[model samples]
Target: MDARPSAWIIAAVVTFYMSAALVMVFVNKAVLNSTPDLPLLFLFIQLIIAVVLLHAGALLTPKIEVPPLDLHTAKKLTPVVLINIVGLVFNMLCLRDVEASFFQIARGLVLPLTISASSIATRSRPSISVSFAATIVTIGFFVGVAPEHTLPTASVPSGLSLFYGFLSSLFIAIHAVLIKSSLPFCSNSTIQLAYWTNAGSAFFLVPFILITGEPGNLLALVSDPKWHMSTLFWGSLITGVFGFLLCVAGLLSIKVTSPITHMFSSAMRSVIQTLLGVCIFHDVLTTNRLISLATILGGTMYYTWLKSNQPPAQSQRPQADQEALDNGDREPKVGWQAPDLDEGLNGKN
Candidate 1:
């Protein structure tokens, strides 16, 4: 068990962290207006970049056997796929409704929601005491906020953003399930599923892009120096390719650490993003927003702490747990381009 940080892991972290900082700068400049078409470009482009980096990273250890998950169990994977579709919708909604720093913060809901999903899916349901703890955490989160919530100006919530975000959270939980179910698929490799998920999303989103005339003014944004082209370019490159991948790696590496712990660890991305939002974009962390952030964090902590005390489920657990779970679903093969592991890892592989 190599405890040392890999070069690729370091690269992934820097890419994702810096990307958030740059995006905040662009948002503050008002360069990211309502339905900024550039975001779409960023999404698609990052997907490509991440895949490229993953492939290149794989080359360093070409002889290593890739442990593709045993996805032959359709009963396990079918439901997961259905739910991942929901995740894409939620992510899109987050970008659409509560964008900028708020999205970064609110998306933390994925933590509690993912934990909720895991508890329900597993035999050990969240106990009444656990539920109460989660509820208090949730309550504490919003206690500091006033009744009046200041909605995002460009993308009004319509209350739908919350719904979609919640839904996305659920699917994300299921995606984690997919990771467990398909654990054998990506083991022993730097697997990335976002590119394929983005490919799937592109299929759904392309029509909307065409129908809404959404290839909007991207060229104009690019040529104009006011938009922080340098930042955007670098952000897209690092974040799209490396940041997201590293985030996934962290989650996978620490799988047995409890779902809440998994989520809380991952939530660092949101915190960094929010701080960046304030620093770069002048996005305010209002009373209501602060409460919301608190609530989400509280809930996430409650879940992780509770779950961590219990014995971990053995099925599809990560290798790092030092628990022997078979991720070897396929005959070991050496290659750079890994078999698609993200297909079931809730599109997050």
Candidate 2:
């Protein structure tokens, strides 16, 4: 029984995942730009919508079963959920502040950071090629954000947005490392983990929403006669639906492709995302920023190539955990692209 997926199927899966992912970013950016003051509220609504959709899917199909949640398992998953939500908050804040074209460059260190976290987690030293690639990525990050750089008005990503991007990358890296350890609590099921993390994240968000006074902001936004309710309402709905679709697309991508193929698809997504951001949002794309993207992409691709060529024992993620990385189906969703083990665990390889 040959189990290889057909080439057309792979192409279809990659296209679906990329399209959903790209749309997710643009839609979220549109909403964030419109309601810059309500990042948490926006994210809270998306989470709720995704949760509702998951519930609906679970009820309709055997493929989408979510195990019942209990206090014991919840306690075990608390750290994962905490990391997930924190990563999400930072990602949203970063997106809220930066141009969508610059967003990927803003978070350019994700590959290297993930490598660092994975190294620490696995207690492994990356090969010289991997270390060199990390250096390239770091250099690209600096080049992209060089001091006194000029572009269109308000084009420079603020220091705060860059800081948010860094923190978001850091938390995402940590989540990638820790999520493997956190999976047994969910019976090694990514679907179950998804339910627990999203539901728990949404549940835990209420107090913060209150503390941040987003509820009041929501009221003001609603009462503002000049504001278009339809934009906010419809934008949220579209992104939420695409967010769920991104999860399913991600799952399909994983089941049908190798990490190397997935890495290439991600590279393509980054390119398309930048182009689309310019076309749709009129984002400024400076020369240095372009160089920064190419350099970072080169380094990550080199890392992926190196890791994939290594012996399977060293290069491959543990089967159970690998599934969770791509499983927007799991905790790290939208805006946060968790590097595959091929890139993240280059140290281990």
Candidate 3:
């Protein structure tokens, strides 16, 4: 008998994955808004919580094997870990300064950048259709956040938030290309790799926090009367748990759904994220931004469809493709994507 889950079960899994991915961004935004000065501290706490949860998961279930943290593996994974942390930091910074809805548009060039990075890494060019899609996304990006705007929001400084978002996209693209190089170290297991990255990030963040003087900021935040300690605690805890769940959900999503379904969900999530941003954060959704969003999503979905139809022999990097499918590139907002991974990972890995 075929043991595949029923349709409803698959639907539930996808829905849960979407919900977790969606909530992760909004929660992080809330926490960042609450403690704007402590982005590193906030990320450090989330990583610590995730690492602790991973340890607990190993103890509770034999199926979840979190390899012991050791020097050898950490050294082997240095490149991946460094890029992961950088990408995450950029992600945090971008999200911290920009409106949540604008965050996705800010990173709209991720798909194009990923394609460019992958092409350079593999020494090959993408097909015409892929190139066309990248162009559409590029056009959409320019439309949404013009470089010479007076200022989308007065509170955000000098429109550098978009620049940070662009940097985040760049690092995310680099991360996507680097994941293939690093996966072999973990025997191609996404969970195993995630364990190492999170643990390593947490370990490395201690000095980062000190070097950046976040401790002083954190102390000030605590000393201030306006901030509530519980908000930070619960926000970090909730984001940490959901972050872990989002990883699991990404894995589950790949097992039960096709690449096409995952891509559709990502587009849907973008729409919902924008709507939620408008509703909860009171983000301004201008007509130009809306058109830009639709353009980006359209180009992305079309790219995925084109890739799905390609024959197996035409695929230059199967492992990278597999990794992308196994690990969705949610990047706090699902913006970073390798050509295949970007489309596949955008749903929230």
lDDT of each: 0.45, 0.65, 0.65
- Best TM-score goes to which candidate? 2
Q: Where in model 1 is the C-alpha error above 4 Å?
A: 1-35, 63-89, 108-112, 140-160, 186-212, 216-232, 266-276, 289-349
* Candidate 3 lDDT by residue in tens digits, 158-243: 45777776776776667656655565677657667768877777777789889989999878888889889998999999988887
Give the per-residue lDDT of model 2 (tens digit) for 150-256: 67558877879889878876775565556556556777666676667667777887899999999899889889998777877998888777766665565456546
Clashes of each: 11, 1, 6
Kindly report which residue stretches of model 3 are placed more than 4 angstroms away from their true locations once superposed.
1-18, 147-152, 155-157, 248-268, 311-349
Those runs of model 2 whose alpha carbons end farther than 4 Å from true positions after fitting are 1-17, 247-268, 311-349
- Give the range of the ten consecutive residues with the poorest summed lDDT in model 1: 336-345
How close is every model to the real structure, measured as TM-score? 0.61, 0.80, 0.79
Error of 2 at 60 (Å): 1.5
